[model samples]
Target: MKTFTVEEVAQHNKADDIWIIVDGKVFDVTKFLSEHPGGKKVLVKMAGKDATKKFKQFHNDAIMQRVGLPMQIGVIGAEKKEEAPKPVAAAAAAAAAPLTPGKLVSADEARFGDGFPYGDPNWYQDWNSPYYNESHMRLRKVIREFAEKELMPYCHEWSEAKAIPREVVKKVAQAGFLNAASGAGTNPSVASLLPYPLPAGIKHEEFDIFHEFICVDELARCGSGGLLWALQGGLSIALPPVMNFAPEPIKKKVVPECLAGEKFIALAITEPSAGSDVAGLKTSAEDKGDHFLLNGEKKWITQGAYADYYVVAARTGGAGMGGVSLLLVERAWEGVEARYMDVMGMWGSGTSYITFDDVKVPKTHLIGKLNEGFKYIMHNFNHERLGIVMQANRLARVCIEEAFTYSMKRKTFGVRLIDHPVIRNKLGHMIRQCEATHAWLENIMYQIKTLPEASQPARLGGPVALLKAQSTQTFEFCAREAAQIFGGLAYTRGGQGEKVERLYREVRAYAIPGGSEEIMLDLGIRQATKNFEKRSKI
Candidate 1:
């Protein structure tokens, strides 16, 4: 690399041939002036001057990695200063100290996530939190390492392919993630179905909802909802009902295979005519003595195109919510068909439109009691919504993290973007939303753990619904702000703005799937009012 003196670099500072020093590195940004997101005027002001302090204040290291380093022409040579050595006595005392479990010599010794402020949940980076312990921290570390190494590198590739490789799914199962996600690590019956132990050093007996929360949160950090859904979207929602309500034989046969990644299952409930209104589903399961004849079409079924089993909601009694029943329908049954559906986002999830015509479902496949499926389905919503909440919050953080990193390196007007008050305002709002929603989510998780099982369904339904809406809205806001910060880069897929673009597309997917924002708010208020009235009467 060529080296330059400070005076030599100063001579090249002009509009037609501009050079500037940032962190002792000289960059020939003359060609880039026209293409700068903040316009050419900003570069003109900093011509020939060292902008290291101004640069570091506004941009993250990502800016240098993505664009700054490539423009470097030479390094400025100046005498480097050496740091004073630590006192020998103090150093000797520090080295002689014994290592103890969970004891750190310094506050800076332990760090987590990407080290970006609000890039991860506050609890992740040594903040005192009631909801997490060393185990949760350990789980977060292992999961994040796994995601960075195994999944993140190919997340975009898999999203474009519109399907996750089967072997990857099997690998997830082998790692015990599938079992943990399927509620196996938390529920005894579900745990019994797992053929292997939980992930190394994790005890099934200690696994709680927060651990499950951590798993989904880490996966969401991959920044592709398509990949997260393809991996566990269907399994998280579909398998819970079976584990909680299915007959022993059905559980033994189906749960193990799914948990082992040998078979895939999806919950098929939404139809062309019915979505949030589960009671109005048109899929029918007519009783035929020994078997029920299933006939109907289910649209937007996550993982449906490749599933081996489906926990389907069909009409068996009269009409409305009372008549619905859950059934385990085999994908191989005659008249069963599934075709992939093209969608805006989450492409790799293999969302499908499924048709069932005169499909025979044995009586043993029925989940819970006849005409009581609505209750079971309603119960499952809390978990599904919670999963959505975790992913949305993380995706929101991904947006903020990406944009925050970009702002520091992306100069605007006469300074870095982060130095602008408007940019800071946007980031401030994003951080507040993410932190507030996450706190609510943690509070609810605590409630679910402490509340009686039966009371949870009625007590938490309203709050969970409200939190889901809050989370999706937060995600949408962050995605929008991040896109604005990146401008054109965020408009295209791949490169620095890839995650922002992908997440922008995925905003609606989260807002609409668990229940649309409007519906969630309304339902939340109604349920809360009803529960409050009942409690007051008592």
Candidate 2:
């Protein structure tokens, strides 16, 4: 915390003893000149000078935190400053004034983070809203901080390794993130069944669906879709069927272990033959007197290779949706094998092709009734699609945030990127789409809360599906536009454009999963038509 004067910093101008000020913090880069990616000439040019403008022109906050902070020698001392202009001073005074009257929430208390404007939700900037409260704010802060400290720094590293370390996964579980992310934290019955408490010390009764939204949204802020999927994607989809419909014996054995992070699970529904056609899945489970002999091949199963168990959908009778049944299959059992698949993105998710060669699943492990798994699967889609909406929407925002930040610091044609009308137009589209999708998402969340649980599938499914498509498409548009803004830097794997590059590669992962955009668009209209007819009493 030592302060250095401008005169004092000027004394270290030599190449062997260099110092520069950035945003009032002094960094002694004497030893780092050789390691500077921009080369020694740039550092030498800024030696013993305020390089705040120059440094930001080529670097980002992540680079600052990772490389610059460590070399900090001291901060620039405060000096005499110019007085504020009359108009600016008056505007500042008015803006700082207290709420005129009847403000529901204090500006300071409702504000969530200091991120860039629109980088977070409008609620984060003290905008009035009915959906969130102090409890939700508490959970947001906790998860955001957790993601920043535990996940963001290592996202690229883990994605490259294609595996998240077990210890970090355990920490996430211990913090109650698993329960929240799984859609279980908001369900009272499911919450009672799990061992973990709601995150941020909110009791089960106080933890509403919006809190669940916050959990997924904040974690996605890490800007690594692979890491987010690897951690919770499979469990969120797989565990719910068990929690909602499995036999008592199966629930007793499987739910606790998975929630505790002692085991992992994947939803093995998509087969090579069936992408969106869940009914066409060819996996079969023949009934025996003692157990079900399972035989199938599951493709593109998230977390499949790393999972200890799988919630599998297989044919139990005839050859369509009516015949499909969900079963909880143990990975440790005989004849079960999983091998990782090389995919375009979501590498850290352990996407795999799994085979079941005469795997024995106890009859007790059957989820709900035989031939009734289709209903269970259908019921689960609302939550799954909503989760996708949460992730895709935030990831879209990450694109806006990264591109916008870069546009500020990066100059083009003798001006900042934001100063270009064409660049602003692209950013405008990204912002508009992202914000509109977010509003739609929040509305769906509100409907989920107000509508009865049993009525939700019928009432909310179509809207959720459409929202999923909207969000992923928004994510896609933002990723592409952000890449355009970053230009060559977005093509690279790391540095200032790391997040934009990674997200651009991940656009397909979001769009194709949780129902493809084409499928969702049709389904939304069809479902809405059916609902409209029913509402008219026709």
Candidate 2 structure, TM-score to reference: 0.90
lDDT of each: 0.85, 0.86
Query: Compared with the true structure, what per-residue lDDT tens digits does model 2 show for residues 372-488?
Result: 999999988988988888999999999999988888878878999999999989989999999999999999889988888889988888888889899998999999999999999
Residue 205, model 2: lDDT of 82
lDDT leader: 2
Show model 2 residue runs off by greater than 4 Å: 1-21, 26-51, 70-101, 104-110, 535-538
Error of 2 at 425 (Å): 1.6
Scored against the true structure, residue 387 in model 2 reaches a CA lDDT of 88
lDDT (0-100) at residue 417 of candidate 2? 91
Deviation (Å) of 483 in candidate 1: 0.6
TM-scores for all candidates: the values are: 0.82, 0.90
Measured over all alpha carbons after superposition, the RMSD of each candidate to the real structure, in angstroms, is 7.4, 5.1
